[model samples]
Target: MTDAAIAPRRPWAYAIFLVVFGAAGWWAAFQLTLDKFLVLEKGKNAVLNCNISPFVQCGTNLQSWQGSAFGFPNPILGLGGFAAVIAVGVTLLAGARLARWYWWLFNLGVAGALVFTIWLIVQSAFVLGTLCPWCGLVYLVMFPLFWVVTLRNAATGEFGSRLTRIGGILLPYAAPIAIVCLIAVGLIFQLRLDVLHHLAA
Candidate 1:
């Protein structure tokens, strides 16, 4: 039996996290979007404050082709998407139970976000070879958001009873899963870059 099954159902728990992280994610995305625009307008002459150090830089990712995969800065999408999350969170906090279809749609959106974040993480660590501080913050917020949504869907039977049972069973594993993902991300960076040198610099 999963902790979720035996543990008391606290709907507010997820709602509260949704509100907190949703707001935070939006704030980070908004800042990144603005900085991206500023960088584009000024070009090479722009001395981005986010360019704190060689390894701890945002410009490298901003200037990369992947940054504008859809011909506009990715942060623009982040701004919009994170805003949607905030709105949904607000609704959830209001004691509104979203519809099954809405839950399905929300899960789809979060799944896309998960995939998108992973792609950007890879691009930053391997391709671009730089990490955007704001983007990193968004990635950190996304994991639990995605996990909670998935578990909620299962609990509520959006994916059927069997999946709901599985979701409850999976609840205890969420933190471990997230930790493994972070470990993998760190490993990728350590393998691809001179981590000790970059840290010392």
Candidate 2:
């Protein structure tokens, strides 16, 4: 990337989000990792404080194959990923300008995280039939994290010149789209988990 294309003025909003939610995601992942270790050492029968309910619990998730698809607990990835985000966010806020290639690489990482996160979401909903509260927090933070990264990258013509124009259109709609996504998550949780029935049970 040409030095001429160095990152523009940091979007203070996303910069702030990257700091705040990056920390939140890191904390949630750390908690989940600790809880997973406890489960592993003591076994599934171990009572865990994070086990809030049959539907809202981390134990069920930690014990599942989906939680360790790579032969390790997934939060290990979160530990590194969130830390990188925090570091980058601090740099941006400190008036550092990154090259276009850096933004491309950053978006690639965000895309990968988005894919894995969506898979986790599916497993939690359709397969495990349960939810990890900490995982939920990660997802909550990740949603905007991914969107902002995409929009910023697109704005900078990271994908291509065409997407640069498209990004401008998308920027205005981000808020409404996020609201719709939140409602969709709620509706899906209600439908898939029969949340009301679980509460009554």
Candidate 3:
């Protein structure tokens, strides 16, 4: 079975990355859940701390149907999902070399999250015409988390040799790509909703 206990490449770094990002994501989700409760307890007219401004607040998003896309608060999903992420990271840190199948599943989970996050970004910026700070925090970490997980799997040959080489080549660029995507989202919000103008108002 070889030395499965020792992950081959940059295991510590990846583990730490996952732990940090997962914790951040969980915190954002936790905040959103609290805000959701406040809205529920006090009614829609409630003013949450997350309700920074009309154009940049969690109230609209929290009250929207999209926030309960799965017939429940979406933050609940994050609470569970990010918890799994943290567990995986902790497992890795504990010197467990996960199987290829596990990595594949992890990749799938993160990719699904990234897709969902993108949809929320579009919905928030264009349709809802508001921004949720807590949701933004979730969105912020998701990009890099997905990118790193996918590339790491590829680099480790969980995909194949071709992707392994490509993943290795592209790994260093993951953070940059995520940053660019975030910037693009910010620009979209600014152009479509006049975020700056609203915040300044």
TM-scores for all predictions:
0.88, 0.89, 0.94
Ranking by lDDT: 3, 2, 1
Q: Tell me the lDDT of candidate 2.
A: 0.84
At residue 100, candidate 2 shows an lDDT of 86
Clashing pairs in 2: none
lDDT of each: 0.81, 0.84, 0.90
Evaluate model 2: give its TM-score: 0.89
Give model 1's TM-score versus the native structure: 0.88
RMSD of each: 4.9, 3.8, 2.4
Residue-level lDDT tens digits of model 2 in 1-201: 986587566668777878997899999989999998899899978788778789978899999999998999999999999999998889889878788889888888978997898889889999998867889888787777888788867876878898999898897776677667656775777799876677567
**CA lDDT, candidate 3, residue 166:** 94
The superposed Cα distance between candidate 2 and the true structure at residue 162, in angstroms, equals 1.9
The clash count of every prediction, one per candidate, is: 0, 0, 0
Worst 10 residues of 2 by lDDT: 174-183
